[model samples]
Target chain A: MNTELKLQALLDGALDAREIREIEAILAQDIQSAALMQELKWMKAAVAGNEAEVKLPETREFYWSKIERGIAAEAKQAAAAPAERAWWLRFIYPATGLAAMVAVMFVVSGGRTTDGADTESVPEDVNAISFRSEAEAMSVVYVADENGTFNPVGQETKNEPEADK
Target chain B: MPQPPDFTTTLDVQLVAFSQAGDMIAFEELVARHRDKIYARAFSMMRNEEDAIDLSQEAWVKAWQRLKQFQGDSSFATWMTRIVINLCLDQLRRQKRTRAESIEQLDEELGGVERQMPVVASNPTEGLERAELRKRIDKAMTQLSYEHRTVLILHEFEEMEYKQIAKVMNCSIGTVMSRLFYARRRLASLLQSLKKEQQS
Candidate 1:
């Protein structure tokens, strides 16, 4: 710190013994520093205990009324917070269940079929073609022997009459 | 409901305890006690009656909401003062952003302006009555920038140490000291000028 601020610290009683001695020594030697220190002391003394008395203009009841209203508003807001959160939770619970159901269905079906359309697959060594329809819930399979003659081996239809089961 | 307990005779600490227990009557008593000091602190910082009143009211509401957190480290009045001071600082910062600072104010904030000011050799406040001294000080305070005025109010009026002022003002200790030095010097100069104006 410079001499001026050191003088200030001295006036505020902020300086330790060593710093006080140092500032005192400076004060004895420098007229300007001493003068500045004196001015600071005067200002401090004048300002202390001299704050202008100010009163809240409103009556006690009037002022307290506003504070009461503010507290009520804040309390209301705090209470509403949990209900606001529950509103979001209402959507979240069903959305979570729907997601879990979709996950399970994907696992059970092995994979998803596009557009619920019929799908046909032929295995490499079986020499057979299989047809499946997710929408109709039906399956048909045709097998071919060494002569390449195709014959129906299995057929299942969800819409078939019970006598045809 | 049964008649509410009499709070007129209750001490501040008891009132605070009751307030903590969700007693609005006790909290109201606390407000009735220290409302002036709190409003004064805000006005001294904000320099506007409307803002001071509004902020002081806001401080009370905040105090009530946060009463559970009051640990009684400081006197209830002091704690309330701190709340109001913080609120005023926030309001001042917001106001500062929307306004332009004068060149003199900028110089004051940047430091070294007090050096150019010549020292007032005679004590400007010497032989003044208590009320007159207060009036002069208040007038002189109005002449300072908010930063300078705030530092003075914090250091001198609030009786806060340099470190405490730094913490409250959200600045470095060096900045606090520098601002304080400038404020004191400028205040001396202004008081001297007021004295001369009166003499003439």
Candidate 2:
């Protein structure tokens, strides 16, 4: 580095005493060198003065409040996202849809024989059974007893059956 | 364990840690400590109060967002200052696109008085009152082109080394030296004339 730069570095605490001496020897060489050193000294002072006198602007509490709000807003935006995503809806909606599907399937395939024996095996999720008599198709329907027997449904002829018996 | 750090030291570390954890209050403390320097840098670059303030504020937000990457390799203020400088440079680049007038064009015409600076004047700022010195420096500083004033501010006021300044200004070391030399020459001449005006 140039001697003047070395001197500047020395003044700024970026150089050691050995470097300072080397620069000091260079400065002792000529009158021009001495004049330049003096100028440097004064310039350093002027720079220090300028730095000290630089007035920091007035940032009000309100300004800080705005920054705080902006940060908070960013944080809120980043945090609130996954919560509003309806993550449970991602699970529950599909689940409820599956349940509705099972129910419709049960209604579609839950037909039993007249003596209440299941004529067709159904899926594993089938829980309870009900039947509807159709005029165009099977005229009657039955409820299945666990003994693999069927009893005709809508057959409660309380009066006519007793009289016949 | 080492002795407990004092309040400010403890606070600085805590602020960094908290801000890294996305704490606003801690980030605000960091901002409050360095906003003046940040604003001063932006203002020196943009040369407008409102734009400087806005850009500086945006820089702080960015710093908060990017706090995780800070490895504490340097002082926290240094890291933060770099953030603000980048923001200012990005702003300058954007403005260049819309205005269609590069800094070179401006320097060729209007900012010449800075490029062709006079020699150092005699004791320009030595004996001046503090307020007068500030005003004179402000005026002279405004006279410098964006390039020169930016180098001067980073070097003189911020006490940045040539290499650090190159990184901040995104320029080469040779350019940094040239700009610093011309800027100081102009500043010396300006200070001298301001002093003369006062004497008269």
Candidate 3:
């Protein structure tokens, strides 16, 4: 290790017995090293002694009241999240069910009935089911026909089907 | 209701028990007891009054939340101090990430300009009165980089060992030692310069 690091380790009492003896030998013979060690000791003492013990600028009531408000707010937030999640679930659960129902409808209608009649073939007939998302400034349009046929359109052509409908 | 017991006179352990038992007043008493110390620790690390107040309050809220986990292995004040320190450390890390590094931070890899200064034999704080010494120390502390000031506060003021500081700082013990060494050296240099300015 570097000499400075060794000296610092010696001061911090981080050295093992062997390293201590070696540093001790150096300190005993080297007057300069000994003085440097003393300086370091003085520096440590001055810092440790004179560290400022600061007080809160606010009053006791003021400080504790802020903390009190924080705790109450955190508790309120913690309690609110689950309720909010449940509220979201109220919408999400039914939305998910609706999506599942729509998927099932698509699957059931994909085949011909035993009576040789077409099922409610909305998948093939409902071409370009365009959805405009209220949250985002964008619209999504999917091209599908009544026969469960699909045709993807480019961005420029995407508006034509919606306008056509 | 019957008169509540004098919580101000109640010991920390009993107060912790009361708080954990869902007594808000008891938790308020605990906050009153150690708010300054916790605030001081945050101020020492963050060196900003606004951040210190905000983070200290947040720590108290966290302490209240985690009061059930307080097994009393340490004093309530000590436990609370740890929370504030961790909050300050986290805030500092966030601030560090957002802002560009300061000149001192850039020089930290090479131990900074203070490392090249000669050691002054005279004690920088020897002749100053106690208040003045404290004032100078606090001012000088602001001159250090965040890492340097943190290590110094942890090792010198908090009296943590290199190993403990390393764990808290998430670095090896060698880094802690080196930082502590540089911090002290830089502080000594700053103090001497302050003393010289006072003389002239």
Candidate 4:
């Protein structure tokens, strides 16, 4: 803090005893500092109890009526808050449930699947083709030799059609 | 069919108690008693009758809503004054954002303008009447930027300490001291000018 602010703190009784002694010493030695301090005192005193008195221009009933209406409006708003939340919550809960159900179905379905579709990969020396179906729960792999004739190498079926069981 | 309590003679504490118990009449009495002082504080800070009245009324409504939070740590009037002060500060901050500041006001906020001002050798308020002093102070306060004027009002008229003013104004204590110094110096300068005008 500067000397001027120190003088202000001194006037406001904000400084400790040591700082007070220091500021007082400065004030005693410096005429300008002392004059500034006096001016600060005058300003403080002039403003302290001299606040311009202002009255609420409205009558008591008139003023309190608006306050009364305000309190009522606030109370009404407070009371309506929970209902407002519940109104949104009504949609939120069902929407959340629907979203969770859709996510679960997506997870169980293992994304997109093709039924009766075959995928083939041909190597430099051999040609092999593979078939899988999540809908039918089955997989088949076929390999072809240099003669261009294909033969099944492996087959697996988790579920097969039942005639009368 | 029960008669309402006579709130006119009730003490503020008792009235506060009644108000907390959901008695609007008691709260109304409290408002009637302290409304002027609260409005006066708002006016001093806002410097407009319309804004002061609206803000004071808002403060009262807020006080009622937050009555349960009132623990009676300070007098009801002081507590009410603080609510109004905070409201005024909010309003002032909003107003400050919308308006552009002049270079002089910006410089004042940046600090150290007071150091350049020459000290007024004579006391300007020495022989002034109380009402006239108040009038002069109010007029001078209108000339200051909101920050400087607020610091003066909080420290001097509100009797707040530098720390308290800092807390209320949401600034550092160092800033509080600096602004206060500037405010007092500038106030002294303005009062001197007013005195000179009167003399001339």
Q: Each prediction's TM-score against the native?
A: 0.79, 0.59, 0.76, 0.82
Predicted model with the maximum TM-score? 4
**Which regions in candidate 4 have their CA more than 4 angstroms from the true location?**
A91-165, B1-3
For candidate 4, lDDT tens digit of each residue in B1-200? 99877878889999999999998899999999999999999998999999999999999999999999999999999999999999999999999999998999999989878889998998998888888998898899999988899998888887888889999999999998998888888999999999999999
TM-score ranking from best candidate downward:
4, 1, 3, 2
Q: List, for all models, the DockQ compared with the true complex.
A: 0.61, 0.12, 0.45, 0.65
Task: Give the candidate order by descending DockQ.
Answer: 4, 1, 3, 2
Each prediction's RMSD over C-alphas, in Å, is 7.5, 16.3, 11.8, 6.2
Error of 1 at A79 (Å): 0.8
Query: How many clashes show up per model?
Result: 0, 3, 6, 0
Better of 2 and 4 by TM-score: 4
Global CA lDDT of candidate 3, please?
0.83
What is the Cα-based TM-score of model 2?
Answer: 0.59
Model 1's alpha-carbon lDDT is 0.90
Candidate 1 C-alpha error for residue B16, in Å:
0.8
Q: How much is B160 displaced in model 4, in angstroms?
A: 1.2
Among incorrect, acceptable, medium and high, the docking class of model 1 is: medium
Q: Which residue pairs collide, candidate 3?
A: A124-A145, A124-A146, A124-A147, A124-A148, A125-A145, A125-A146
Off by over 4 Å in 2: A1-41, A52-60, A72-165, B1-10, B96-118
TM-score of the A chain in candidate 4: the value is 0.58
- Models ranked on lDDT: 1, 4, 3, 2
Q: Which ten residues in a row are the worst by lDDT in model 1 chain B? A: B101-110
lDDT, model 4, position A71 = 94
Per-model lDDT: 0.90, 0.68, 0.83, 0.89
